[model samples]
Target: MAGLTVAALGVVGFLGYQAAATAPDHPTQARPGSHASQSKEKDKDRGRQKKKSTALPAASGTGERVVYALDDKRVWLVGADGKATRTFEVGPSPASPDPGTYAVTSRNEGGVGSDGVQVEHVVVFHSEGGVVFGFSAAVDGSMPDPNARKRTGAVRESRADGSALWEFAEVGTKVVVIP
Candidate 1:
């Protein structure tokens, strides 16, 4: 029943997105100066964009890189040929690095994360104001509570994704954060 509900919602959301994209707004009903309406429209557009788009970010530098998008909570592993080899969603970290390029500075095969979770494939990238940012997978295959009041900077991924990232992004690999 839960799966059915999710499938139904996905179908509904896709249909709504398609209708909005192709529908013509009536000129007589246009509220060109209505800030509220404009904001709502932009929100809807962002939702559609997140659902439908996974194209590598244009400004993310070429060559092999790990591209992390702050707003989307998604990461793309790009190859040297400038193609994304893998993309996946991540559990949001309490801390995020600024939008820029950095390199994978360190890594660990397995260890306990700052959040106190037993994790593996630890890939460290950036640090800011005492917060160390990296990607890892919880050994228990669990995700942290987004509402929790923790201050850890581990951007958690699924076990499979973590292993893939570990193999792809070794030390010195470029990591790009984009807003």
Candidate 2:
């Protein structure tokens, strides 16, 4: 009878170990009366907040300006209060401009883009070695691929974004480029 009892305990111990080894690393079973639906809703809300958040680094100078993050391929139209009024993604050029503060020197309502696309909202800010750096948007709302051979430094954005930039960044508007 004692031998039988030991054998039964051994069997139970082996089964318990097997069960634990096969279990998932995370919790697989839900607790009774747990708020699973509420947890899912909270997770979705967190995702939306994550999407809305853009952690902007410190920008140079003061007052209203447009901040372009070269590494992130993002742009933020900062207001005079140093708050971002608008933000969007952009297609960077292979020829990166030197990180510094610049002013919009010129504007064109429409032009034939370097990639031969009909573009609008051309805002020129910097020119070096014959490559004029600026922001533009295609008329068809398409972004052009950065052509290393062309030596153009036009940062392409969406049509709507370009329109906003065109209206916001006038001649002499501050543009801060950051690495």
RMSD of each: 11.1, 12.4
What residue pairs clash in candidate 2, if any at all? none
Query: How accurate locally is residue 162 in candidate 1, as Cα lDDT from 0 to 100?
Result: 97
After TM-score superposition, the amount by which residue 33's alpha carbon in candidate 1 deviates from its true location, in angstroms, is: 20
Residue-by-residue lDDT tens digits, candidate 2, 45-73: 98786565466566555789988888778
How does each model score on lDDT? 0.88, 0.85
Candidate 1 local lDDT, residue 35: 74
TM-scores, in order shown?
A: 0.72, 0.68
- Error of model 2, residue 67, in angstroms: 0.6
How many Å off is the CA of 152 in candidate 2?
0.9
Summed over model 1, clashes come to 0
- Enumerate residue pairs that collide in model 1: none
